[model samples]
Target: MFWFVDGEKSEYSGGRTAVEIKSWCTEMTGPAVKEISSRKLAEEQAGTKPICVYEGPEASTDFEEIAARKRTEFTFYHVAVDTEKPTVSVQHKSEEPVACDDLTFDGLKKCLDDNTLPLFGVLDGETYEKYMTSGKGLVWACLEMESSDDLEKVADEYRPLIKEVAEEFKDQFAFLYIDTIQFKRFLEGVLGVTELPTLAVNKKAGDKLKYLYTGEMTAPKVDEFLKNVLDGSIEPTLKSEPVPSSQDEPIHVVVGSTLVEDVFQPDKDVLFEVYAPWCGHCKRLAPEYEKVAKKVAEAGLDDMVVLSKMDGTANDSPVESISWEGFPSLFYVKAGETEPIKYDGPREAEGMWEWIEEHHSNSEGLKERVAAGKAVHEEEDSEADKGEEL
Candidate 1:
């Protein structure tokens, strides 16, 4: 169950938007629980009504059991709906331009302290793992160096520009700096950083990890890249290891982790199987999945619909997406469509073809599938809202 306060229209009109409660979850679930609890209490005492306890589909059944152990275990949020406009006091404060903080060891450490956005700082191994490795949505890490005064000057020169961009994307993305001198191995080994002032955008689409941007960083160039990433115009670099090649099989091997290259860009309907090695169900479904792949190729849907598979066990970052429902999961990615539709029909090759023929060919059905895929993400966000309490 997730708890948050939301504004609605008189119970007559509908309203749905999750806000401020996001910050509360971090404080309540984090290390400083006592401090956060006291603060939360103070806020409530100030007459801020707490409302809405939403129960999601994936919420734990053992809510009472968990609540027994931890008093903060939120079962439901009080629903706060306000239709009337209330008068409020206006307090004026000095307005100033947002500033960017320079990257340092201490500043980088502090990045992990909370979920604050536009947190631009140097990223070391510690910061990288906490913010980048398992990072959700768009996380930007711009690499810099202190080896040369000129290089430092270049970084300093772009600080304001970065700050401007960060401020605009503060709500959706996280921007950080990485000093190559401090974390040389991580820069080279993990991120494959070669150029100075390379602005790299780390993103995960579905279960696939991809870098949206990694190149030269000028104000205009970086701005264009940022725009492209936001609008889904830029191609994403995969974060997973290379897919093992298979010569004899009819199945097309997904060479890298880039969903854009293998899944989205291609003009074909994709039947993707996300399976774990250890799962018995996955093992049982492998041969059938292969059959579906071979049959699809034979049916001449190979160009229109390609069959693909990814080892969920082998790849972590890509599969860590909110799109990953479970192991042995199958999805239908229609050609030219950005969203992949979950395959809930029979697993047999014939059933697969029928499903592809019926929904993939029908434009309206495809739209519903897209809408359904979007709903899944919304659910995931709600679950994330409840995660802190658990």
Candidate 2:
């Protein structure tokens, strides 16, 4: 991955006046960026001078060799051109205090600590100061749905006007952005979010977001959606579905609520997972579930997917419904129907990703709804936070 920073780090020694890019290579790769044909290509591509750092593999055990009366064979310097190195010190990055609209883990925690009024769009960090102190205000989350297109695709095809729309809302609200991967999960079935950019606002655990913002998010469009949802003018899109697509959908199992309506919701989705936690397959899906959650959070699409978890293992938390046929089963959902998607074995990231790509949601697979739900269940059911639902 490429990371852009104006400042230098310990690994980089170039002076601040010139732009520089650094690379590293493990023993297996010889040296960082060494495989490249030209350092100039890397420099040109990075818009900065390029440098590589390598740590030679050391396999010679001189002490043991001497004791055994054997020559101390060495594997040092197998591939090397430079021996010179520089030592530099860089100040560790300091974290700033969380702001009300920061959208960071720390910020979420601080808002929970400091707020006397209602707070919304809360992320990972949280506190109990308000509920204990005032007892009336609630923290709400206003999330944007994950889209199925990449940044550029969204730019070129799906929502060409998002950048401008974002610029307008930059000041009015904290506009967390997401890429195509997240959008794919969001667009899978009808979530009433037929439009490209969708928003969800929630105040409680069981409640689906009432306030929404969808379509080309121009200032006026955003205002209209928000005004309607927040003012109770626009009823939340409960049975709303995204525009139908040619793609296959995820296993749209519904839990808690009747499968009366179709869009895959979190509580409903996890029910598929929780129902058969002991299935050797569900256990295998743990890490993949994590990948989905981490990606959604990193992409700033956590709000849109509403990825929550339930542990079928726990007595208190079991998959509310038993789709035994759906257990170890995969499917795509739409409208009010559920279609079984094939799964090779236990639910895993690659397996699920492949299923999602071919079947429901975006082929890009940015939002791992199943995985996210698994993680949510794990975190919530852990001994410490068992009573609290995130």
Judging by lDDT against the true structure, name the best candidate. 1
**Which window of 10 residues has the lowest lDDT sum in candidate 1?**
86-95
Alpha-carbon deviation at 227 in model 1, angstroms = 4.3
**Count of backbone collisions within predicted model 1:** 13
lDDT of each: 0.50, 0.34
List ranges where model 2 is wrong by over 4 Å. 1-150, 156-172, 176-183, 186-218, 230-235, 239-390
TM-score of 2: 0.25
lDDT of 1 by residue, 243-271 (tens): 56544677665533644457664466777
Alpha-carbon runs more than 4 Å astray in model 1: 1-137, 142-172, 177-198, 202-224, 227-233, 238-247, 256-270, 276-281, 291-306, 311-326, 333-340, 346-390
Model 2: weakest 10-residue lDDT segment is: 87-96
- Report the CA-based lDDT of candidate 2 relative to the real structure: 0.34
lDDT of 1: 0.50
How do the predictions measure up, each by TM-score? 0.39, 0.25
How well does candidate 2 score on lDDT at residue 154? 37
